[model samples]
Target: MQLVVARIGRAHGIKGEVTVEVRTDEPELRLAPGAVLATDPAAAGPLTVASGRVHSGRLLLRFDGVQDRTAAEALRNILLIADVDPDELPEGEDEYYDHQLVDLDVVTVDGVEVGRITEISHLPYQDLFVVERPDGTEVLVPFVERIVTEIDLDEQRAVIDPPPGLIDDRAEIASSRASREEA
Candidate 1:
């Protein structure tokens, strides 16, 4: 299987180096030197990593045969893909691959069927799971330990404990909370 590992950003310097927005958690291993990655456009690569370095909290990489700023700029916004084995898992116990989470059934702690995970969105601070409800509507569920309690791969489901108004409409949640408080 092929997984998107990074996206080529603007050229960093005049030495063929380009900044990359890393998608994979294991950048040191996946984006290492001599690693050959396929490009999204299907014509920009397969670009081999000639060298890589962390500069001012950003990852910069230079590809083989891509020298100078002009050459690096030409590859801007291109996505880098890596060939991965389907059975390969992440090193960390709690870490999960985006492919593994996608398509899993989403349910509340009370066993209420909510939706199915359609996609995983990785942000700088947190990750979110895009869930498609049975009614065909979509909801963004924050992939946090507090909200998402468990991921049962064997059962093909994700158990979530969402806060009031998280899954339901805010007005409904507000009225329900008020009624409970009154009682």
Candidate 2:
């Protein structure tokens, strides 16, 4: 599978260089001279990395054939993706990629299947798992260690307590807040 590693922001200087917002933690490991990277799915050819270096907390990349400000401006908002195997990812125990957790089945401690995870939102304090139920209701579960007991990526399942009425209470609170803001 192809994973997004960075996004081309804008032309940094007049030296045919563009600033890249690095998404991967191991930017040095991923960026290299002559490395192949894809921008979009329909992108004709992989962009060859002529050179790359970190400057001002952002990755500065110079692509082959892209010279001058006009050429670099054309690459703005292009996402850089690399072919990566999911199994090759390094994850510690109880850690998983946000993409992997999405679409996984969720169950309770008693083995009762609740719903399927549709999305994962990484908040400042904790991660939130958005589970979609068969009845079309979405339950936003907090990824707290106390609430979420276990996560089995291999089995594509997660065991969570979620607290009684926690989902409904949060939904009501959100609705009320929205109404107040609209007033």
Using lDDT, give the best candidate's number: 1
Give model 1's TM-score versus the native structure.
Answer: 0.82
Candidate 1 lDDT over 18-55, as tens digits, reads 99998776788889999999999999999999999999
- lDDT per model vs. reference: 0.92, 0.79
lDDT of 2 by residue, 42-127 (tens): 46347989999878666799999988888888888888888777777555765666667778899888887778998776543567
Tell me how candidate 2 scores on lDDT.
0.79
The list of candidate 2 runs beyond 4 A from truth reads: 91-99, 105-149, 158-170, 174-183
Provide the lowest-lDDT 10-residue window in model 2.
22-31
